[model samples]
Target: MKQTTVSERALVLAPRGRDAMVAAAMLAEGGIEAVVCDSLASLIDGLNAGAGFVLVTEEAVATADLRPLSDWLAGQQEWSDLPFVLLTSRGGGLERNPAAARHLEVLGNVTFLERPFHPTTLISLVRSALRGRRRQYEARARLIELRESETRYATLFQTMDEGFCIIRFVDGPHGPLSDYVHVQANPAYERHAGIPNVVGQYVRQMVPDEADGWVDLYRGVLTSGEPIRFERELIATGRHLELSAFRVEPRERSEVAVVFQDVTERKRAEIALRELNETLERRIEAAVAERQAAAEQLHEAQKLETIGQLTGGVAHDVNNLLTPITGALDLLHRRSADHDPRMARLIDGALQSAERARVLVSRLLGFARRQALETRATDICSLLTGVQDLVTSSIGPSISLRVECSQDLPPALIDPNQLELAILNLSVNARDAMLEGGILTIAASHVRVDALEVSGLAAGDYVRIVVSDTGTGMSAETLARAIEPFYSTKEVGKGTGLGLSMVHGLAGQLGGAFTLTSAPGQGTQASLYLPLAPGVAAANGLSSDSTLMEMEPLNILLADDEQLVRIGTAEMLRELGHVVHEAASGAQALNRLIAGEPIDLLITDYMMPGMNGAALAGRVGEINPDLPVLVITGYAGGDLDIGLPQLTKPFRQADLARSLYRLFHTGETLPTDCA
Candidate 1:
């Protein structure tokens, strides 16, 4: 029920002027717009302009050659068929006249009225023809609207983002449908599925792997008359697709419409996220374990530091007490040289016992004190060879010893004596572990130490000394405290527990590190890392066997706060053929030097009541720049920089004699054995 604006008036064509006017007047009076034409040419023009109905006399239609009008009628639009009302004479017999009938046929939908008909009849016939013409115009409007709707639908189907395809099932040998063919596909279908030229192709032929299950899914939707949505991977294209299918009309033949989109990237991202989460969990577990281990190491270090502090305080007191005792023993031995033979034997025994005690005290002090290192370029291979015999004899013949030294190994910068002692201590410990006897291997090699490889050591070249024992190794509990002072695993009185602690101290003081590896059942391996020495020859210590030089007696100033120590030391110097002056304090010693007491040498104790020995030495240097001074101390604390000749306390007659000899010949070149 749509409306149209096309002309709804009647057009009249009559050669007879009167009849044409009459018909026009009648149509106008009957409420119809009418147009009258005087000739066939004018009537053709009127039809072209648009008219609801045509009024023409048979004479006008036949005599005028209506060919142009017939052609116009044949070319009419599908929705239009022009209506015509014809007026003819009653006795004309137009049906029998072929030419007249043919003319009449050209004007389609014609209504005939006789010439004698009443005016009311003519008007009614014209009205009927006009109504029919209006219906034709309405049909034309509906046809145009239908075409526009179809155009819009086609545009949407082709341009939508999701792929759309219509499939019709093909029948097989056993059933109504075995496969489906692509009946219609949009532009997006190829992009989403990575398949080109898909339309009009059967699903089985295009993607054979997917045909079996995919056809079944579509068939079920068609039979059940329900829609389905799911996801699948296309084997041919390697694409993940999200698909939705619904049954189309004519479902008995198994026709379906499908919409799909590619979701491969989304699926890949989900998997990557899951893997990242798993890796993060593993890293977190490792970090937690590292923190726990670090805490345990800190606790052990704190415990060892506390015990070292207590042991250091006790060792300092012992050194002080032994100073006077050893000094008196030296004096008695000298005086008892010609005593009874039995008394001389007793003296020899007592000196041996005191020497043993001194060695034990030195080990305790090594664990407690952070002493200055006298580092020198030492050939490690040669040093190890020198100690091999001593170490083998100490371990006994039950255990075999092997020394492996690499050729061209780098020299280590360390105190030779301390390193030798450390090696000896490690060898003894190895001997004790091998109750049933085992092989002890000592090896030396040149190695490069990276910064991260060792704690508290810089990246550089080092000499690595490894000691391996095929003996019962330590348990975890014992290994953890192996470097702690006085933490012995041996039975009471069997071990001092200071062996590894002293070695650890030596390594640290020399700017290196010590590492021990052991397990309950496996053998033990200990590595001593010493930094490579700057290129230089080895520094030798003063040799005890060096003969004393003959020298003229010189005036000497001997100063000490302790009366016993001062008197005892003065007597030893006097016995060594030197004039000795005594002073109880640094102030008293300075007074004698200021008064021009003819002092040839100044020997002062480091710790005195007023002004220490270093201060006295500095004052004496101002008075006599060339005066030689010797500083003696029982315990050399952290500050030992006196810039004077140093001699450790509790010395013998020979020790004083050697020191005096060196002082008199300070300007002369002495033998290297005095180093």
Candidate 2:
């Protein structure tokens, strides 16, 4: 402590002798507690003893090292600059020695008083030193608070996960420029950049790419003093780096602060999703196009079917007109005398040409679904034999036709005429494929299609009739479309494309399965599998004694909307020596029955205006359950879900005669001759 009259208590040191003791005594007499030290060691000891300030003799402590005392005082945290007064020697160079003056600077809060000074001067000097020391203490307190705040910020900066940076612009002697001097950085930034000691380094040293054209991004922020945020793709070594930059505001010159994050995975995922969506969109477009094409094809098929129906109706009417004309002409030829040879010859030639026209018309009606199917429980061997003869005559002498019938073939429930036509169609197709010469084989076998043999087929039985040819085989692509209607490999005018489609349609109508197998160089084979009629007595490939020509007249109820057909059919029935009644529609037929018209048979057209053939049958059954109805139409069994003995249109007088005769004479609807 330094003695002074500035306050109650003070300590003053003039020298290490009597002056120091006098000063201490004066302070004690003045009722002010104080202590004085002559040497640097005593000064430190006095300070340790709870003295607020120290009084020292500058000359006495001139040779002594003040470093230890200063260090020890500084170790007292906040009290490092406690008060002290330096008492100079009376005559020495205490105030003049340059070395001592330099060393005196070590005592930060010490005051100097000349020797021989008054008590008031020493006291005043001591009080002034204490005041200076008090000021230093207040400043030290403020410094401690600042240091704590700095420590808190440094801890946060080091521990944060995001990369943070601060930059500044320094004005040099030459010009003002921007530089990123890192004031603080986190561990994440150091690890991300693979760089150590990032703090205190310039941004140019950390990332050199930013100094290129992208520097404009940073420059804009600085010029406008605005916070800018943007993302850019950066290259770090060979790896792609997606960095986001945010420029801090309040730029002094052309400097900015930015923070960045890695978004590589997110970018890649977005790209992959975009590609997938594009691929899916393309697939959807393709599906839409395909569906549209299929719809168009279906529409075309339906239009063709409708046209066929109209053609079939016209052909039926023409056939009916031609049948009577040709028959009457043949009758006239027979009745004409042999003496009128020229007249007879002309009539004969005309009848022959009319017969050919009738056959062509019948084929046309068949294609149009107006031709009747005479179903029969028949031996397939005989039918195939018959087809072989027909094919041999029609396919020219170059093509050889053969029949390969299994020794014992089961009877199939099929139409004989349709089956023969199907065989002829196959033979013609084969002959066309061969062109020069080829062997056509019409074969039949009793096929018992068990469930295990062919999946989805019934375990009962089927009759497989195969027509194979050693002709030029079809490629896979050609074979795929071979069964489609109007598709053909033949040249124009050589053949109608309806051959195969008709065969397929007929097979389907017969409740049969048709399959075709062909390879590029291995020829073609078509197999037709028909359901075998139950309890049918197997044919021994011999002619049956009973025939349709020997049958009796059936009490036939001929129902047709066409007046010509009704009247002409009745006249034909009267010629056949049978009782015949006529009705226009199914409703009229039912009315005749209500009028008690004895009708043992109901022969009705399938298509009628008010009551269709099927609906009439159902109603007529309610009236006469014992009566057997024979359905006849231009569109019977042509994609309609109706069941009856349907006779197709364009029937001859003989055909109608034979159908009724056979039904009345024989109990079975199918003929004995094999299909």
Candidate 3:
């Protein structure tokens, strides 16, 4: 293939004189390359070999066929405009000679230099010509880069699935931005829009009926420089287009780039649904009212959730504060037998008061559903016999209490501590209703049920406990909203309204249901249904009065964030015959393990600031998997599922020893040494 590669060489043609040779010598002195040709035909051939610019004598081109030279100039690339220096006789500049004008026409960018001119002048002119040629080459390079970039963009534009176009806002007879023309569109445009060859088509021409709407919509986008997403019906084609558009950069161009998808099928479905909904207006109204009620309930739940967070935090701190007080009082009470009779009585009262504070904290935790449940198979009859005294005291002398339970009923799986709290709450509510006096009867019985027999219960045998009052009964309206959290009929200062809610939550937590039935004249009956258990209750191991059992003392590493809680717990552990080591945080505890410290057991606070007990235990597993880890927490429910045994806080010396017994003794309670 014939080709000409452009270079910075000057071509000279002066067949009749030493002009070509002289010019070549002058250019070489000026650090420019030159090629001299003997004839016009040779000059044309040199031009084919790619010269930056040509210097030809008037005599050389005045007599020869100039067609080839003219043709080469005409065939030059758009970026390339070959500069020429025409050497002529004396006084032959463009203004002085008409023939020079003919040479100017032949060489589009021609310069005239007469004979007998100074060499510097000739060099200066030639240098200027060459400088112009260099810029032309630079422009050519830029054009090549632009073309390659366009090639990549075109590939993506053609293959993209989404319909895309570049439209220019054009002013029409109506005013400014009265029309738009699709200057570019992808191949997929027709598949999506059902309009082929949209390029170079006006918006009005394609969908004249909807042109004004489309124009105004896109006009806003172009003016504000804000991208928009909308769906509009193209009325002409009856197709709905979901489109997103943004103004093209260099905003003066008034062009917008649009990406769109045809959502006609989805639009049709929506329209059909709208038509069908017209027949069910009454049902929809009912649904909306129900949803409003649910929303209100959710709003209340959100408020309670906020309160619950604050309550949980307070409970954690209170439990930590109580840890040392309870520990000191417990140790004092155990050694009280040797003290004076009056001092021993004082110690018993302080210990009892601390127990009351502990129960109060548990009640607050229950309201937030953060209290951990310890469910076991419990004899309903026995549990009621134990709690009757507590309930009787709570209701006062005005309410006469009655209790009944079937002797043959099996044990029900439940948390007796929480159940006791719920019983007190119900009895108190019944007492409030009967200001003068009333009978509060609590009865327990077993019943088998199918799914249809209960609202929320599965088909199974359940132990039902009913607390009925002979006081002024509740209206149906009051009964309906009775169990809702924080909904109270009692006057402002009388009740907290969390009692029934907590009871209901307790039943539900143990795979049971709590329901209330009442009428305006009839007294209220609150029923709690508990799932049946497989066997009799295990003797509870959490009693604080249990004596410490003798076992091998452990090299225990204790980690806690609070200094008081840590010191009190460590003292308890040390008194139980264990060698205690303390760390203020879980990270310190983990570091001890990493340093290969001897540790038989790791007792850590669950809510340490950095590297909590669970994380420390996990890291400890990598070092020594057999090491026994017990997580002790004051905060009950949050990130507590670390798959490790946990002992909650506010424990005495006996309780700490009991948890240790579980670790060292395993699956059996050790008898008190009583030494």
Best by TM-score: 1
Candidate 1 lDDT for residue 511 = 78
Residue range 1-675, candidate 3, lDDT tens digits? 012375888888887767778889998998889999998778778877788888888888787778888898898777888899888886657668888877888888988898878889988998999899889888888888888889988998999888999999999877998999999999988988999999999998888877899899999999999999999887778789999999998899999999998999999999888877875886898899999989987987787788778878899999899888888777776677486667778987987898889888887787766888878988888889989998998889878999999879889898788888888899899998888888999999998888877778899889999999988889878887887767899999988887897887788778898889887767889999999889877553345455776679789999998998898888878877889989999888888988989999999988888788889999889989999999988888323777898887788777777778777767764665531
Worst 10 residues of 1 by lDDT: 539-548
Q: What is candidate 2's lDDT per residue for 516-590, written digit by digit as tens?
A: 899876789998888886657344332323222444555678787867656666776666667888888888889
Q: List the residue pairs that clash in candidate 1.
A: 542-675
User: Residues 1-675, candidate 1, lDDT per residue (tens digit)?
Assistant: 112448888888888759888888988889888999888888778777878888889888666677777788888888888888877775334664445567557776777776788889888888788788878888888888987888887998989999999999888654668987898999999899999988889877897777888888988998898999999888788888999999898756568999999998986787788888888888888888888888877886786677667766565456556666666677676678586667667776776676666555665656665344466899988888889999999999999999999998977888887788899999999999999999999999988888788878789888999999998999998998898877898999999888998999878878789999999768889999998877864745435552445578889998888887777788777766789899989999999999998988999988776798899999999999888998887555333776678776556666667777776776777665644
Better of 1 and 3 by lDDT: 3
Kindly give the stretch of ten consecutive residues in candidate 3 with the minimal lDDT sum.
537-546
The predicted structure with the larger TM-score, 1 or 3, is 1
Residue 20 of model 3 has an lDDT of: 79
RMSD of 1: 6.5
TM-score of each: 0.69, 0.57, 0.55
- The alpha-carbon deviation from the true structure for residue 467 of candidate 2, after best TM-score superposition, in angstroms, is 5.6
